[model samples]
Target: MLSSLALLSVVLPSALAATTYDMVKEYSGSTFFNDWNFYGQFDNLTNGDAIFVTSSVASSSKLAYVDSTTNRAIIKVDNTSTVAFNDKRNTVRISSKDEFDIGSVWIADMYHVPFGCSVWPAFWSQAPNWPSGGEIDTFEHWNLELHNQMTLHTEPGCTQASPVQTATVVNSTDCSFQDNSNAGCGVMDSTDSSYGAKFAAAQGGVFVTEMAESGISVWFFPRSSVPASLSSNASSFSTADLGTPTANWPTAGCAIDTYFKAQNLIFDITLCGDAAGAASVFQQTCSGVCYTDYVVGNGSVYDNAYFDVASVRVYSVTGMNTIVRVSSALGFRAGCWVWGAAALSGAVVLFAL
Candidate 1:
């Protein structure tokens, strides 16, 4: 039998009024809605228009879905490959083929970025003309160790110097390949042992960048650590404890406030060489084959190629007024304090009467 999951909802107090929103749930058992629009060069779609299966390595994977439950929508990408050349041999390249846009806000969450001699996984956003509308790369990993980078590709006038933040692992000797430039991008080193065990292990989590009135706030939640409040309330997380700010952020050059406006959500995966203009960047990550054959014999090395989306919700805060009134006992105490002597005599007489 097909199952139906209840949509998640978030409620806030009147004093801290904010907007509330929710994303319509889609699962193995559900009907596809018309609000969704799919864009890319691939096939093998599934799961209520939420999942797309494709075989093209050098194709783009851009799919959008509307959350009927919240009037908002999300654009997603799945695993797709790109084309690149190693000296003379042509190779299908695989980087994180996922990118999306919401109104003016854009986002991309990357995983298994190509490395070694040649590999690049990028999760970036762009506007109309290359860098004209403004490009905000949530995370980008190039050929390096222990370092992750965050860059803003914009007009020449833009002055924000791209800052690269590095992650510090107590035991770096164990997983050295996992380390990279730690710009604003968060990191989980290979020394951790269980770094790339599976999808739930390697890239099992949520990287959210919200563009709201409060400004742009980026959050990274491991699969196990995501808060229910974020899943329920979606909109107002001002009071959430996201920890202290990082040092040397890209605040001086690029004003996040001006560039980040309200945006929709996107979830996608693609291969290298998919994005039209960014072919050179894609070439850097492509290997001999676009995708590696993990299906060895009867067993499979790609055991963790699944995205288990428990739910997606949105929220809008509601306003309410609270009233305070003086208690009866307090009123009587004031009268006694004001009419002491005269009231005492009158009280005795009245009591006797």
Candidate 2:
């Protein structure tokens, strides 16, 4: 009787504590962008709650445009010229006016970012560099995917490879790399589709990042399976509501909490050659070229580089636990080892019965 009771206790709690998350926000039309704050100076465009542009020439270039079907805004990039790093030349800033206290877990529904030769598009964050403020690149595709990278640019040692602590995904050799300590850390989702287009598909998906007192976890969910409530705030969801866990949680060598806990969010779409050290990759002949010539020749290549954000929401865990529960039910079945163990344990019980 005692043994049976103990077994019931374990199994019941495990079943009741199923992993679930809430849907904080969702967007599905051209009207969503109306309330966002837009920055950067370019002319010749349409302005409304639906579309925005810096220059009509830039807009026509294809690097910047809007999509009505997927209801996504794209930021395309062309390697022909170096517009990414120029602080003054090309920049687009879009952020939410509402400032919510971001807890450890958050997600972004982004459609795509640039991934061509010599192109750089980043979905990152920043705070004043005081107690040493820094940057976290959630999705960074640089130099033709040779080294799809994510890093923390902070007081030395705060990079992706040197996370202060470590964590791992279940049953896999794949690992998350925290290149620097204070700078930032990230994992690579090496699917063939770019981050932007993947989120914008008809099945629009979810990009989730959870920063717990214990660590951080990030995962993506396709639109078809995403909960309807999470698709829009028409209803509210708590973490406890996320039915079963998905095996996609980060379970490798770096601590997710170390990089994502208690941070503010920033959304900006920058042209090529804007960051500090991204110019050398440009073709030699393309140097000293003006935006007009580049657009005329092959410049308009990046014209569609845009990030359509359906919604951004933050959640608080309110506890200090280190282990993040992930479910293998979504395509990721429990491995052979776990199944074998369960069978052996059950056999032992049957003999006793």
Candidate 3:
């Protein structure tokens, strides 16, 4: 009886805790565009001076394509054509066809990210219902800021808890969209190589985000610092390997499972929009107004505005049993593994029988 009780204490916890993560979807190479839905419209959300082109326009104009030389995907703005002072330049906005819920991990391997004066680029995830479903900005920054900002925007109640384990600095703790002028709960990366010209110069990096029941964590690994298990061909991953994250939003104050759900990954670049066009924000990076100096140009200023992506992969968590069947040492039924307290009581009855 003593031996059986000791075994139960050790094995029961493993049975409930063991989990495996599997790659459910991958967007990469030539087939990357097939899984995305292009947003062919104006920048209505931010009121930016950008025309999100249709798939046909994107292909015909070469705004989005796979680079033949590097075999990587490239989504870029129109740098060749001249735009009239009143017109908006052509750009691309796309969202994944698939939707992911919590208990998932997203990894993006990149060679470059869009950046320039008046350029607002973001790689993020959001649900269809806006703040109700929640929004997670994995990579976002504009103008001359050389650091990535990770943020979460939800309904009125969500906020970051104290002493969140992260390497980045917290910008705002309030995640409520209605509050803080829509700043959300933001954490800025400390490394200068986190965004823009500096990021591209160091050959780019990777952004990993895990949305779990406990909370949300984001990590930025530069080209030289990426883990070996996170390669493009990796079919599985263990979150335990990723050390202290760049930003962590614990569930002590915010219930992640209630706020975040059914999210679709998105990438878009809008020029001279709300965030980048604000007078106070625009003047910090470049001279002259955003619309007049940058958006209305001959497209020469946006030469560096593009995303050279290697791949974006999503992994879903699946529960699995890791405990081996007991050798009938405690008179347990064959192939019957106990779960909770009820199951454990039944096992004891079977042992007596």
Q: Per-residue lDDT for 226-316 in model 1, tens only?
A: 5675544343444243332121124444455554422222233322222201323223333333323211121121122222333333322
Worst 10 residues of 2 by lDDT: 332-341
Q: Using Cα atoms with residue i matched to residue i, what is each candidate's TM-score against the true structure? A: 0.42, 0.51, 0.84
The CA lDDT of each predicted structure is 0.28, 0.36, 0.74
Q: Provide the clash count, candidate 3.
A: 0
Residue 233 CA error for candidate 3 (Å)? 3.2
Q: Show how many residue pairs clash in every candidate, following the order shown.
A: 48, 72, 0
What is candidate 1's local distance difference test score?
Answer: 0.28
Candidates, ranked, TM-score:
3, 2, 1
Task: List the candidate 3 regions with Cα displacement exceeding 4 Å.
Answer: 1-20, 319-353
* Candidate 2 positional error at 334, Å: 47
Report how far off residue 145 is in candidate 2 (Å).
2.5
Give the winner by lDDT.
3
* RMSD (Å) per prediction: 25.3, 16.4, 17.2
Write the residue-wise lDDT of candidate 3 on 138-234 in tens digits: 9987887777878898888888875244443555677877654565776767788989998999999999988877788888999988888885458
